[model samples]
Target chain A: MSWFGNSEPEPPSGPSPMDLAKQEVDMYSDLFTKMSGLCFKKCVVKMHGESDLNVGEMSCVDRCVSKYMEAQEKVGVILKRAEESLAAQQGGVGGPAAGGVPGVPGR
Target chain B: MTPVQQQDFLQHLESQQRKDSLAMYNNLVFRCFDECSKSFRSKRLDDGETKCINVCAEKFIKLTSRVALRFQDIQQQKAKDEAAGVQR
Candidate 1:
């Protein structure tokens, strides 16, 4: 959609899907870095030495990161399913009601 | 307004739209945090705690869908009831 009455920008010339996926991963990693930092600090109360975390502490951080990723994936799946079911209920096979066609069951 | 003034106004509007999109993203993150970090009892998350967060997210979306459907059902039923009443 055009914003502020500006014309739509041209599509990127380079690898679009890869670029988009990389961008998404970067955003998620930024979020994960913040969350994992907090969790790591809490779990790794005492560092063995400079730049050293014990096995338990390291494991905790690993698990925390994994869990965060899993949570993100789960949220994505949940939203996708909700959209699909709502679409079905609205008379589309697996998404929101399509445009056009009267008395097609979608309001 | 002059052409330059119009251009500036459009740029400002675009910036505001970007801010709004960022705010929407932040709100989603906050929602996820609420579902994931409900309790801070221990420094380390228990075995099932992470799983709970995933489950919570899934259930929350499902609940949202159900609520929406229920609302639509109620509206349909109400309309049907009103039509019957009118027919009577």
Candidate 2:
């Protein structure tokens, strides 16, 4: 259905835009797998019956996803600040250093 | 597209994907630690922990949008200065 329609015409014979979209999906799939493995280790202490996921586990998973999104936003903010300061310095604008250096996430 | 063109396009996408994946990985680690790994005694998140996770997420998003607005201001200022210089 015309999802990623661009002004440029479709190439007659090369890797289509669909391939690019597939790559994006693959990247996100990898991210989901890693995030799930990490949260599972951190939150699922007990099996607690044979229902696959207990109530506590389910709640923790929900929180975990929300927290991860938050962390991404925080990191993005910090990164942009850092970039700006670096640019300012290069431009001789003498901008102040980034405030409250945000810690690197995930490692 | 020619073989060279296709290779270049794929290379660009790969680099962008790599950067995104790394950022996601880092954010997940930090957020999980902040939200769920406070106490090692239990794997289950307590109500407090659950609340903390939600709040932490919200706060970070707020901070990000604020910073983005500030960055936009700088970009506009830069553009204005460049335009004035060109007119001179």
Candidate 3:
């Protein structure tokens, strides 16, 4: 999904938008896989006890998803703030080559 | 650079990002497992171990966020010093 959604100011200059979408899907799956494993580790701990998810495990998974998303949100905030601060420090010149802004060269 | 080179560069970046994320995921697993896992006498996890792992994951994420903020502050200060040195 587009992080900016519909509010994107302009098309980003890179691999086509379709590639970006694909990247997003890859990222989502990565997140889902991690969350699934975490919840399994947390809730479905007792594999030998019951073959099916117990009432508590079911609800634990439910809260696990929500709480995982919240954790993602918190982390995203920190990352965004860090990116913004870095960009500002480098005088708004940020990208793959986010070195300090270079002095203008005479042609 | 040529279009082919640009595409290659972008592809490299995407690949690097995937590597980075995977490294991070591995880190979480390592940390939570180290902090939570005690005994492997049985294949099943007990209630206490499960709770420990759950809390460990949450705290690990929170810890990273705290570090990110601290890192950003240090970077900002370093940047300011660099600018000052340039002026001097």
**Cα lDDT of model 3 by residue, B35-64, tens digit:** 678899889977877877676666545444
Best by lDDT: 3
Which of 2 and 3 is the better model by DockQ? 3
Residue-by-residue lDDT tens digits, candidate 2, B24-87: 5577457645545467677787766665555544443433333334334543554565557558
lDDT of 1 by residue, A1-107 (tens): 10111112324553333333333334433453455444533444431233344466555655655555456556656666677777778887534322211111212
Candidate 3: residue B41 Cα off by (Å): 14
What DockQ results do all the predictions give, each relative to the true complex? Answer: 0.02, 0.04, 0.04
| Candidate 3 runs further than 4 Å off | A1-9, A95-107, B1-88
Candidate 3 chain B lowest-lDDT run of ten: B63-72
Top model number, TM-score: 3
Model 1: DockQ against the native?
0.02
Q: Where does model 3 sit among the CAPRI classes?
A: incorrect
Candidate 2, A1-107: lDDT as tens digits: 11122213444665465465444445434544455555655655532223244466566666665566466557767776776778777894644332222222211
Q: Report residue B66 deviation for candidate 2 (angstroms).
A: 31
List the candidates ranked by lDDT, beginning with the highest. 3, 2, 1
Per-model RMSD to reference: 20.1, 14.8, 14.4
TM-score, candidate 3, is 0.47
lDDT of 2 at B31: 65
lDDT of 3 by residue, A16-58 (tens): 5444444554565466556665665676554233334557766
